[model samples]
Structures are given as C-alpha cells and as structure tokens.
Target: MDDVIIPVAFFLILAGAVVAVAYFQSLRNRERDRQWADAMEQYRVVVERARTEQEATKLQLVEMSHQVKALEKLLLSVD
Candidate 1:
C-alpha cells in the first residue's frame, strides 16, 4: 500500500505540471495570433493611403500638363 501511494502521488504531480505548461502555451499562441492580425490591418491601411496619394499625384500631373499647354499657346500668340 505504501509503494502504491507514492507512485500515484508522483503521477498526479506530473499530470498537473503538464496541464499548466499546455495552458500557458495556449495563452502565448493567442497573443501571437492577435499581434499578427494587428500587423495585417496596419499593412492594409498603409497600402490604401499609398494608393490615394498616387491618385492625387496623377491629378496634379494632369493639371500641370494642361497649364503648360495653355502657356505655350499664349506665348505663341504673343509672338
């Protein structure tokens, strides 16, 4: 009976330790997943901002071209 009790107590202690380690590992994984999601969201916002800036630059270029053409025509008329 004494021998049986010692082994049973050791087994219970080992099982508890394993359970604790698994719980902590689960928590770590959840945190990592959340960080990944946040990074992806940030990346999406940055990409959208870049696209908007590109469109604005395109509009500016078009306006500049029209102004240059008008200036050329006015100078020719002066001559």
Candidate 2:
C-alpha cells in the first residue's frame, strides 16, 4: 500500500506539471498568432498606399507627355 501511494502521488504531480506547461504554450501561440495578423494588416495598408502613389505618378507622367506634345506643336507652328 505504501509503494502504491508513492507512485500514484508522483504520477499526479507529473501530470499536473505537463498540463501547466501545455497551457502556457497554448497562450504563447495565441499571442504569436495575433502579432502575425497585425503585421499582415500593416503590410496590406502599405501595399495599398504604394499602389495609389504609383497611379498618381502614372497620371502625372501622362499629363507631362501631353504638355510636351503641345509644346512641340507650338514650336512647329512658329517655324
């Protein structure tokens, strides 16, 4: 009876420790997942901003091209 009691107590203690470690690990994983989601959202915003800037730049270049063509026609008429 004494031997059985000792083994049972040891087993219970070990099981409790294992459960505690697993619980903490799960919490850590949840925090990591949240961080990853936030980073992805930030990345998406940055990409959208870059796309908008690129479109604005493209419009400016097109406007500049048109202005240059108008100038060239003016010079030809002067000649």
Candidate 3:
C-alpha cells in the first residue's frame, strides 16, 4: 500500500507541472497573435494610402496629356 501511494503522488505532481507549463505557453501564444494582428492592420492602412496616391497621380497624368494634345492642335492651326 505504501509503494502504491508514493507512485500515485509523484504522478499527480508531474501532471500538475505539465498543466502549468501549457497554461503559460498558451498565454504567450495569445500575446503573439495580438501583436501580429496589429501589425497587419497597420500594413493594410499603408496599402490603402498608396492606392489612393496612385489613383491621383494617374488622373493628373491624364489631364496633362489632354492639355498637350490641345496645344498641338492650336500650333497646327497657326501654321
């Protein structure tokens, strides 16, 4: 009976230690996930801003092209 009791106690202690380690590891993983989410959000904002700037640049180029075409037509008329 004594031998059986000692082994049972040891097993219970080991199980408790394993559970504690797993709990701490789970907390660390949660923190890492939160940080990754924040970084992804920031990246998304930057991409949106770049897309807006690119659209504005394209519009400006189109307007400039139209002005150059009008000038060419006027020069031909003068000639």
In order of appearance, the predictions have TM-scores of 0.76, 0.88, 0.89
> Model 1, range 1-79, lDDT digits (tens) per residue?
9989999999999999999999999999999999999999999999999999999999999999999999999999999
In candidate 2, which residue ranges exceed 4 Å CA deviation? none
What is the Cα root-mean-square deviation between model 2 and the actual structure?
1.2
How far off is residue 6 in model 2, in Å? 1.4
Q: Give Cα distance to truth, residue 53, candidate 2, Å.
A: 1.0
Residue 6's C-alpha lDDT in candidate 2? 93
Of candidate 2, the 10-residue stretch with the lowest lDDT total is 1-10
Model 2 lDDT on a 0 to 1 scale: 0.99
Q: Lowest-scoring 10 consecutive residues by lDDT in candidate 3?
A: 1-10
- Steric collisions counted per model: 0, 0, 0
Q: How many pairs of residues in model 2 come into backbone collision? A: 0
Alpha-carbon local distance difference test for all models: 1.00, 0.99, 0.99
Clashes of 3: 0
Which residue pairs show collisions in model 2? none
